[model samples]
Target: MTVTEISRLALYGYQIPLNPPLPVGRQRITSRHGLLLRAITDQGEAVVELAPLSGTDMDGEPIDGFSRESLQQLQDELTTLQPQLGSTAALERAAGQTALPSLAWGLGLLALKLEGQLTSRQPRLAPVPLIYRLPNETADELVQRLATLPRDCRFAKLKIAQNDVEAELRLIYALLAARPDVRLRLDANGGFSLTQAVDFCACLPKGSIDFIEDPCRESADCEALHSALGLGYALDAPLNAPDFELSPLPGLRALVLKPMLIGSPAKVQALIAAAQQLGVRCIISSALESSLGISDLAAFAAQETPDEAPGLDTLAAFEADLLVSSGKALCLELGQLPLLASWEAGC
Candidate 1:
């Protein structure tokens, strides 16, 4: 069997500022910190990111909802493997041993890129649909925001279960009244109990929502909530569960696939195959990665779910760009980030 080869490698550390701070779960983050990997192999040059999402309040209580391991943990793992990172065999072995999804994914992508198995054959630009996430704003503000959206943008996602339930309901009703052509996707981030989710769903007008994502903390509870309301639902964190299984559920409509949170490229393709077999839509979503990472996701979405609109509207939160300019649309291009280390195979 022929193995992939990486003769040179470089690592970069970045602290891109997030304009207005991005809120996830219980914490608001002013900046995003992570590492970038650039490698030279027989196929050509390849780049991938290792940005793990974590959420902590000012008091540091560990509220990370998206990432399974902290950023420090990921860095520690990389540090241990730094000695042999230039060897494709070493990267493959380390990827097999690590439980951290971000690390495994980074290594896996490196291998794929080295073999020229990704993007080289796929279309450079795929016209996938786009979903815009409405920022938190008052009724009038949201109305103006909706009015400014591009004519082709028809779907919108809103974060719920964070503030007053009644107020959120009113805001949704008013926003829809202003632009009834837009379909809404509500994300609760698994913040509600079964009863709470049911009660919240009951208040919304029937057929007003396309789907609700991560309505409850437990997958069972999420399924039960779907049963109670007969509303379509999408799975997010459940895709990262240690014992996640792809089975048929009555109201299961979509799987929110975040490559950073998911283990490896192989596993991601497997999940997509299984989900599609079960007639569930697969949505390639982002984990607030930098422009480089977001561009990678745009390529992946183009190759995988070309027909579905991806949830990649998080790029506007970044204050500056990485390798590319901050204002450009998503594309498969690598730009220079702050270098942390460089290694060449025999040097």
Candidate 2:
């Protein structure tokens, strides 16, 4: 059998503007600037885009807690290590020494792609169920965005902990009442008090919510609230920096996996295995990376939990899709990733 060897590695940096700017927590994400790697192999090529949340927001303010890993580091590593990364085994070994989880993940995926092990089942490129993040804005603007929701849309995720509590509540009520059949996920980012979380969860008509994420900071508080309401919540920030030794919690409905931040590809696989063993659902989401990141993200999510929609509606917020070599702003569907990568690679 002919082995698909790594013939070349191409590194790139891009800053794609975001329209209407996604406001998550305090950051108004106006643009995405990150590093990507193209692993050119005998078979074809595989793309990996790093999704670091530490980039500056639209206001040019630094996003809190971004790691020290930068674009230059990834490029330098690829350049210095190019000669050594000639085979799948070599790339797999390289991933362990790399400090940046995103970089390691990229190499790991490239190896898998070249070896024809990226997927075990099929050659199909299908769309994952995506949950749209409702922007935290005025009631009128919220109503307008809500109006665009597809008739068949089954899930919606919203952020809370607002200055205008009444307005936020009104929007939540509207979403719940309007689409009783649709399950909603509220993310407070651990910024709320237990009382506030309880109040917010209480407002929901029974069975309208799928889960809440990081409602409060303390696990004890969250566990108590879970006892009170019997509603489950997923851990986001906590899971990002996990020890991978967690047992099942009563209210841990799911673990939102961010492949880039979670360590090497092996670590991500272990985390998923652990979560599945605990009977917890797995939801893979991106950190707002460009085409490279979203491409692998959709692949990973589809591989793990294709039926459950990952949080990938962030694609709709971009002003331009930098993945295209022509650099035109076009519709980016999951199926178009390979073509987009080839275009970017100028192949």
Candidate 3:
């Protein structure tokens, strides 16, 4: 067997526009921008891009946290490890450090392994389901977009917060009113108080919501919120804790996993196993990563029976996604999001 090693890492910037602004509470994002990491193999022809999740700032300002400085530092560190490790397994072991470079290197090695097992000349990849952030003014516009989507698209997501509970409720009502058959999920980003979250859940029209995600900040309170509303809840931020333990919340129906935040595929698989044992739902979502990251996520999602819809529809979050939307579905050819032509590194 020929042993290949990582040779170089290149970072690129991308910006992609959204059809409508993505709003979470008062924040509205018009475009998506982030950093891309490309890893060159010793084979010289094989390359894999590693994109981590870095979304727009509080004011919906686009900022690339995966900067050139950070990427170069990560690359240099990984290059130094290549001689000692000499194999992907050793690199995977080093990934436990929780450092950015280690995480990037781990992801790069994983991607390289995936590239080696090419099942097809052109791999058939699924489009990530996007959850549009609807502004108060054009909330109806989002509904219209959802209503127009093809019947095959069984999932859509909405962002909500405690500040404007009534407006969000009204938006949800309008969406359900427009598309009675579509499945709907909500993400509050832990924006609501326990009391307020309960009230909001109570106000929701019965069966209108599929599930509510992280209505409150804490996992304990998340369980409480679920009990109070007598509805299913999903955990997001709580699972990102480095030393987090799974306590098995009764009403908790799902767990949203962002690999960038979790930092390891092993951890993700562990969470999935725990969630499965506890009868909790599992969804693999994105943190506004580029196609490189999205490709990894899509592969993960495909491998699971996601209980709640995964938050993989982040293509619109970037100014350029390597994939394209074919009606309601995303088109991926050879791990590239074709819609984002501007951000194509190797494809």
* TM-score of every candidate: 0.87, 0.83, 0.75
Cα-lDDT of candidate 1:
0.75
Ranking by TM-score: 1, 2, 3
RMSD of each: 3.6, 5.2, 6.2
Choose 1 or 2, whichever is better by TM-score. 1
Which candidate, 2 or 3, would have the higher TM-score against the true structure? 2
Q: Who wins the lDDT comparison?
A: 1
Candidate 3 yields a Cα-based lDDT of: 0.59
> For residues 83-187, could you state the per-residue lDDT of candidate 3 as single tens digits?
444344444555655356325434544554434632222113334255454446477677788788777666677777844678878888888888787667788
RMSD in angstroms, candidate 1?
3.6
lDDT of 2 by residue, 88-138 (tens): 787787887777777787777777767766664321333333333445655
Error of 1 at 207 (Å): 1.8
Output the worst ten-in-a-row residue range by lDDT, candidate 3: 338-347
lDDT of 1 by residue, 1-347 (tens): 14666788777777777666676664667778888878887767777889888746435666576787887787777767767676666666677678998888888777766665566332233322233233565567866777667666667788888878998888788768876877788888888888999999999865778789998877788778877878889999889875688999889999999989987777788899999999999988888888777777777787888877788778776877767455654332334445677777535
Give residue 243's error in model 1 in angstroms.
2.5
| Ten-residue stretch with the least lDDT total in model 2 | 338-347
